[model samples]
Target: MSFFTSNRFQDRQAAAAEARKAMAEKFLSRPKYDPNDPAVKEREAKRRAVLEARAAREVERERRRAEAAAAEAARLAAEEAARIEAVRQEALARDAAENARRAEEERLEYERKLDRDARYAARKERKKKAKSPFERYR
Candidate 1:
């Protein structure tokens, strides 16, 4: 037969109940005011000291980490600023070059127009000086 349905199961239950009762009685018999004992006090003080030391170490570690992160951030920011300034300078130089090229082209066109006007005026003057035969008789 399965142990769960056997007579031995009753004996096991009884033994388990007795064990639980014994454990409860032992727990109740422990001294309640042991905190003032020398050994307990020394152990508590040592634990607190260890906890304080760990806290101090953690704080120092965090401070160093924060400083390192800030330094890295500042370095990155400086690099970005330098890159932006370089790009701005390049754009300014390009714009100045474009303006200079446009000014040169305008100057060349003006010079050509002046030469054409002078040629046209000379041609008109020559035609006016040469008159027809009827005009000479009059």
Candidate 2:
């Protein structure tokens, strides 16, 4: 003998169908109806509204964060440009200083050469004017 005709199974199945129909009708209604003095349900609705608003606020916060990141990136780029310019200026100054040092060294070398040439010329003239030893003795 099967338990298919049990009274308990029939009652449970009927109750389940009724519950399903009620749920379906509630979902299909356009303007939802809340019974008068619906404090508990009102609180639940308010809670859901607050949760949705919080989600919107989070989206706005993310947008602002992205904008701030972009601004920061721009500022960093400008700073890097300034840093590169400063380095270029420093390199130019170093090159100028090196050139000046080289010029000064060349000037000093030329002056030393001129002094040596003058001394050599004066010694040659003295040798040419001096009398011979034999002439002096005679």
Best by TM-score: 1
Give me the displacement of residue 71 in model 1, in angstroms: 1.4
Best by lDDT: 1
| lDDT (Cα, tens digit) per residue for candidate 2, span 27-84 | 8974556556588689888999999999999999999999999999999999999999
Q: Give the clash count for model 1.
A: 0
Root-mean-square deviation of every model: 3.8, 7.2
User: What local lDDT score does residue 66 receive in model 2, on the 0 to 100 scale?
Assistant: 100
> Residue 138 in model 1: shift from native, Å?
16
After aligning candidate 2 to the native by TM-score, how far in Å is the CA of 37 from where it should be?
11
Each model's lDDT comes to 0.95, 0.92
